[model samples]
Target: MTRAFLRPDDARDLVAEQFGADRRLTALDRLAGGSKKGVYRLRLDDETTAILYVWATGENYWPPSPTVPDDPFTDASGAELFATNHAALAAAGVRIPRLLMLDRDNRHLDADVALVEDVGAVTLERLMEHDPAAAATPLSMLGDALRRMHTTLSPKYGKLAAITRGEAPQTRRTEDVIVDRALGHLDAAATRDARLANAHDRIAGHVRLLRSTVTARETYGLVHGELGPDHILVTPAGEPVVIDFEGLAYFDVEWEHAWLRMRFGDAYPVLRPVDLDPHRLELYRYAQVLSLIEGPLRIADTDFPGRQWMLDLAEWNITKALAVV
Candidate 1:
């Protein structure tokens, strides 16, 4: 009962109010949505057309915590960012979902959702669960897809100053800024300076190292910002398609790559630097694990593996955080 639901009519009426009418539209089922948006499954009258309904988040939207409101479309800027960013990616020859419509009104709907062509693909988590032998297959494709994403398209997203970036949930953040904000909540914001409590020095060191070592150009491209089996979808034909660009932003490729390794036991792609700068990677890895240790770090619960995932990442991070080297 952690989550609630918005009915098919409620979804349609709300979406229709913001998105306008679909002549022969059919009822839709609100399924799962991540941090900034709501995702719904819509079936056309013809039964052949499948449209994914997305509604961003907004305050006063519904009930409070403990039986969370089903609404996902809550913000205005995020919807706009999602549209333009994804559109740019598509135009750049990247394979992304086709946008059917986008709203930018910060009112009731908050212009917080977009309609896109849904693919009958299975999430990487489902694929991995169904067949373990097929697990590595997704990882390889993911590497190539991610490389293309980071190398080719990321630079297109210009970096805005901290305030501007912070305004939008799906903000473009350089490593330093991201660290400060993400770890800020963990800090003693209740106090005057909002100290990061026990984690201040460690987080600062990682942030400094990340800022100094990662050159801008090599990492300048658009980062998925968040990459996990859940965010990636592998089709029935074995094709890899990525979704959820809400958090897609400008960031360091290495930071993102280190996060990716956490999922596969921190031992994938042959585990480079495991022999060299393992300490640094460990710190980097722990920073991310620590983020997940808090409930708010997650985008959604569609594929969340629970505290086990967090504990595992934390264990790996702690093992490395304590490394004598």
Candidate 2:
């Protein structure tokens, strides 16, 4: 029989155990937007509220693919690592949720879960969508928050595990990790779509040019691997609080900025003083499209909502990237 992952009653029991025995879970409402985790808002009888996040494991979660190999992180230790990163980011003056408890052993749930403070914040994506013109303050705050995060330096480049283990992480070279992943994706795309063969050749040349012009920087820092507007939250007080540290890594700050630029237009100014090359930035932007394409490719057969839209967007972005290259 399939095991039930998480239900309201289970959440209530967990909350009761963490809070006093008399404390009761008055309400359990599932929040939306995470692809790999179940997020919920819990209200207690004492009128306090908290957010519960349950991570999916095994095949339920996306596995490493040729286009995006080297999965440096796992959900087994996600709660603990998230808490650690939260503390580090908070100390660096970046606003984030306070992790209350980590359920690693599945003592109260079927999978790994994290209980954190609910700050009553809205996602930056929603804010931007509501009023693009009024998003200036939050956008500026987001830039500042990213700058603060980058200040938390790492000794090496590539994955967070290597840095955390006190070992030198993977280094960047001309045929760096991103290039390899891009090539893999292009190969797959060409096999599925013959029309992409010419575009693949163009992208290959562009990758070579990108590597020739860009070199690894002396400084490496905490980079939010996925820094889309959706991951940022704007509190009721107009403060920007960054969330979702699972994809965090120790890599070039330029990659993070590149993601931000791809999500938000080029007009978004860089708040930090890191040297950025236009070509490198464009290459990273193209790489982001390649990474995005992996998702639709992985689930092409499934009945995923907006699958067509996702594929279309990937193709459109690929065309845009190729045009620039």
Query: Highest lDDT, which number?
Result: 2
Candidate 1: residue 47 Cα off by (Å)? 1.9
Q: How accurate is candidate 2 locally (lDDT)?
A: 0.68
lDDT of 2 by residue, 205-232 (tens): 8776777766555666778777788887
The 10-residue segment of model 1 with minimum total lDDT is 67-76
What are the clash counts of all predictions, listed in order? 13, 0
Cα error of candidate 1 at position 121, Å: 5.3
TM-score of 1: 0.64
- In candidate 1, what are the lDDT values of residues 64-181, reduced to their tens digit? 2221111111122256557655765575455566677665563434345566767665777776677766766766666666666666533333332221444323343344444454
Error of 2 at 159 (Å): 3.3
Residue pairs whose backbone atoms clash in candidate 2: none
